[model samples]
Target: MTSNLTDNTLDLDQAITSIKIWDQIRDAAQKSLRSEPVLEKMAHHIVLSSKDMAQGLGRLLSHQQPDTLVSREELEELFSFVAERAPQIITFAAADLEAVCERDPAATDFFVPFLYFKGFHAIQMHRFAYWLWQNGRQDMALFLQNRSSVLYGVDIHPAAKLGKRIVFDHATGIVIGETAVVEDDVSLFHGVTLGGTGKERKDRHPKVRQGAMVGAGSILLGNIEIGHHARVAAGSVVLKDVRAHATAAGSPAKEVRG
Candidate 1:
């Protein structure tokens, strides 16, 4: 039997009927169905059979989640519920796919991230978990958070705030603490950490502003601000605020070029 989308999803389906991204994915799926016989069944099940972007994405992500704890059908239902309620997630998810294709040279098209990239998968999972966390469904949210960590090797707290067009390049070993706030257009490389420094409870994580780029293996501790367009060099341990357009490096990261 087929699943049914809620009113909002149906409305959103109509709203995005002409959006190019959906057309791109559908076209790509059709091509893969014709060219790659091995993936034809999978592609048809995930993309061709679906009516819209949200439903297709929900099925795709849900296909990756769950290892006997929950069925794919159950996760798909939960994801559908999240999208119906928080339609901005659909917008952010589309922006995320665009960001990867635009920023990562290795990513060639929407089809790549939509089908294979773990970073893209992990981020969408967090968006759903974050929504659950916000709407008083913390237990289920944390369950999804754990699934994301185990599946993708990227751990972002359900309470951590994220923004649009965020790119996590080679995102393995990334950790975002409970209070961390990563703003729009931010790019974080593999092994990057937005972590707490000490024992004190409130607002302990770093706030990465819009257009900031944190390099691979870098760690930003405490509640410091990494300003707009700022750059944190690879392997640095930032302990202070980095002003806009500055580049921070070294163990106790200092502003090298402002």
Candidate 2:
């Protein structure tokens, strides 16, 4: 028994070192199949049979679209295009997955969020659509945005720049406008809007710097900045720049004691 346990530990370590996140997620899905017999077919279809992380994510997101707007085959083709052209997205997705696991207490395993979390799904779709926008496919990008909003209730413009390790908790009603920029390690809760207060077209959106947390129902409007490591309290309406590492709250949010 001791020898068997030692061998298993070594094998597990080897697997972790050799395989990528996709493989880790697949292994988790397979294990879940045994424990969750009802999800066997879903797991097989979504994760087990997929060739790679990109393919699996593509299939999963595409499956959510209405058949009237875009067929699964067409969306899969677009997803493949983005995956092939911009491989860095896979890295971003891996980082985002790690972020969700680390930041969300409810997350137990990789497969849990990959299969069920709308936030993760919404962000991945935004990444793909962003790629499309960068490649001069504006209409297609907008189409994807529309579908994603309809499916997940998260509306993020493809042109909005988002960094890795972003946690969108309870992603519903989250709106990010076209000129918005959210840096790395940022956490946005439900009903958070990085939007414009007026109709001005040029750069009319908020810039959320690294390590910031925008609480639920908080609105950061116009060309203001939420500095690094800052925290905006829930339901606050921020109209101006927030200093780094500060905590801001209330309507037309003001920095309070940290």
Task: Tell me the tens digit of each residue's lDDT in model 2 across 131-222.
Answer: 78887999999998988898999999999888878889999999999999898889999999999988678989999999999999999999
Give the best candidate by lDDT: 1
TM-score of 2: 0.91
Local distance difference test values of all predictions, in order: 0.86, 0.85
| Best candidate according to TM-score | 1
List the lowest-lDDT window of 10 residues for candidate 1. 1-10
TM-score of each candidate? Answer: 0.92, 0.91
Model 1: how far is 166 from its true place, Å?
0.7
Off by over 4 Å in 1: 1-18
Q: Write the per-residue lDDT of candidate 1 for residues 71-104, one digit (tens) a residue.
A: 9999999999998897778777787888898999
Error of 2 at 203 (Å): 0.9
